[model samples]
Target: MSQGGTSIPDEEWERFLREAEAGSAGAPQEPSARARMVTRRLREQPGPPEGWRTYRPARRRRGKGWYVLGLAAAVALLVVALVPGLLVGWFGGGDGADAPRAAGETQRPDGPPAQEAAGRLPTPDRPFSGSPAAGWADGTAGIHLPAARATGWMSRSEVEQALDRTRDFLAASSLDRAVLRGERPSGAMALIDPHQSDVHEFIEKAFRAPDRENDPLLLFSRFRPSDVRPAGDVVRTRGRISFREGERDAVEVSTDVTYVYPVVRAEAGSEEVVRTVVRREVVLSWNDPAKDRVEPGTFSLVSYKVDATNGGCDNTYTGYFTPVFGAERAATGAGDGAVVDPYDRSTPIGERMREAGDAGGGTATRS
Candidate 1:
């Protein structure tokens, strides 16, 4: 090839080829004077023809500000990745973390929020005076039985006797219309075991009504002992008397009394009486006197609970009577107008009864 657009004559090219052939033929062929002259002439390579200039790559140096910005961006990305995990570990509960928490500081997965949990309130020990189920309307009207004073340690027989006396009094007085009519039975108050504040209050509330003239039949209608028939006698089921060193002696007597009564209901303007068998569970507690010698008449009633009712009788209306006029005689009419359904707790009679003046003995209209 012609070098860089320089032309080579045919004679010179031929001479060069002859020299190259001579060199390859195993002859010691050093360059001859003519070949040297010809090579020197070919070595003069031509440059670019008119105005082309050589190009040089430019060098760029970055400033400190660019390096600083790159470094800051890297640091910011690292912080963004790690900050949430650090926050969770610091303030909120972290995985496998066992940190101490303040008292009452609870965390429930499905319960109320943290503020509500921290500010939760406590429940009352005793919301009302009587049974918890009775709510504010517990018939006792906020009255609680007084604690009974104990006599000395009473024998089981003595406890049974006291309970028997209590049962007999309850059975006899519970049915007497005279007792139901706001008239205390003779000596009935004595049988009440004066220490029983609950019994005393219960008796007091049972026999009186808000208005004697207008609601004359209210007290009687609510409680007519005429319906009660003792199955046999008060039967003692459980008796326990405890005497321990360094402790006050206590007697607990439980008895089951069965009463048969007719639960009367007015149906279709007529009267339907259904006899019910009610099992009353009477539990009594007596404490021994703190002194060495037993005090006479110191035995007192502590607690009494009526158990489940097995039979059905609306005998609640035995006291509720209508006035009947006759030519020669006057008789009490049927209890059709009596609102003595013991199960009818919604009746306004209980409120009215509480409004009645404090009576010595009264029965609950809605047992």
Candidate 2:
């Protein structure tokens, strides 16, 4: 049978020849070896005249030297085009099948990076629970007592010592010349909880800002022992301590502190001292089986917050003072220039607080 422009089957051609021979002889003829040989020779002959041809199979044209050379060149070009990409993928450059990645683009194990997948703060292992006993309030300037009795995790004396140590450390660090010069205070990490990345970032930024002099924390260095009325009253500090139970054998001790300091400034070319009152609420977490253990009386500072600020100082300036401790404001200009808010809420401390309230009372954290 014909297929497209090709010839009929070999079986059909053989049958036709047998039928013609039988009809001519008037009987089935067993063809002689000579006749069969002649028939095979005719089938083998190339390009017979169209009218005379009975059976002819299509032939494949043999390529010339140039044709073979052209084919070889095309194959070489194809291999050259693919080898680089194949090598790149095999050597871990990237998925070579896809477009090459741009510089600085992070290669992910699968899909997009974690931050891009969902624009939200990371969920804490154990989020803060419960609220501060007293909603944000002013802590008086005196020896305020603890609101709740100490639990087994932390004793009354241990809590008292922790508070005292924290207060003293803050005071000492504020006046430390090394810290003013952008050097981290010694033993500073001991007071901070290693697991609290936010607190650590806040501390680093407060001390390590490129412009050391303009750093907000440097404002504390301006205070001299003689600035306050009483020699030892340079720091008018007061705090109230409280405690609550937390997950994983931990105790949350909240210390509401108020620090009133004198910020001496030159206004209208005249010397004037501004009494900046900074109120802050600090939460210290004490865990029995902490990853980083301290001396018997010490506790880790998990978190802290600036509850409120008043006494004519801008909230931005006062806020930083409590949490870490600005902005550049002209010494003589009143309300003419703005103070730069040094506290970067995008930092780790701000990020952590966004996920959970400072006092642990809010159900939803700010992402």
Candidate 3:
């Protein structure tokens, strides 16, 4: 019905029905009631003015919608890729969760102090335990062998300084002038406390040879510092020197050390001929620091020979030196004497020619 409604005749309605049927029969089936209703409403709307109502085709849009969709997809993919990495960082990785505790800690379920754990070493930053009185006794027995002769061991600092001096002495026949005065005499005196006093003294005195003695050329000079360091109190210092004799080289060496407290002293002498080493003797004693004397005890020295040229040998000597004997020997300058510089002319007529001609054994003569 038009906006200006007017009743239509029955004949006009019949004619309209006939035309709709003809249109349906000529093409597809007729529209349903609802579709027809929608079509009539659209047709009834007022048309554009004048001839402009004729016709106009629709145009497709080319806006940013497609680009926006592509951006959304890329952002989704990036999120998927980074999520796992972010989670791992927030929580610890596999390694952190499974790692074992560091060595030095107490392994018991009720963990004790970290320093006491098995196989763990206290860091350098930590302080050493209580007094060093018996500290050296437990950890470094090999350093002071033969309990009877074990006394004064060297302090770490003392050993280090002595080694430094040795290097300087070797370079120039003098101690580092900046550190000490005068020429570095060819003798080494690394003295520790009473604990190992006898050992130190014995070593200092034992490593000497008269110029007329069998072997003249003292070839090698070296110090081997071991890791089995004294905890405290007792200390150790080792020096090795080689003397050339015969076709083979006879090495005279000693590790002079002392054990403090119940003070013990030792001098371990070793001789190497060819490729074999013979532990010549080990001197030991109990020391009385107050009196600056070795107590009333017996010290001993053993001699052994090894023939490495044919493989090895087993010839060992066993003996002991009593306190009385040691005292007598010391008096004669055989047990504890002023460090002798073989190179020193004052060493006596017999020993003068045995002196090292120069700091470096680079030059040699039969004096």
| Best candidate, TM-score | 2
Model 3, range 254-310, lDDT digits (tens) per residue? 222111111112233311111101111111111222323322211111111100011
Model 3 stretches astray by more than 4 angstroms: 1-188, 192-274, 293-367
- Lowest summed lDDT window (length 10), candidate 3: 63-72
Ten residues in sequence with the least summed lDDT for candidate 2: 66-75
Residue 139 of model 2 has an lDDT of 13
The clash number for model 1 is 23
Candidate 2: Cα lDDT at 15: 83
lDDT of each: 0.26, 0.30, 0.18
Candidate 1 on 50-168: residue-level lDDT in tens? 11000001000000000000000000111111222221111111111011111221111132112222322211221111111211111111111222333336544554444444433
Off by more than 4 A, model 1: 1-152, 156-160, 175-188, 210-247, 263-273, 291-295, 307-367
Best-first order by TM-score: 2, 1, 3
The candidate scoring highest on lDDT is 2
| CA error at residue 303 for candidate 2, angstroms | 2.4
For residues 150-264, what per-residue lDDT tens digits would candidate 2 score against the true structure? 6645566555555455544443343333332233555345554444443345445544541311223321222222221111112333344556775454666555444433333
Clashes of 2: 6
| lDDT of candidate 3 at residue 234, scale 0 to 100 | 17
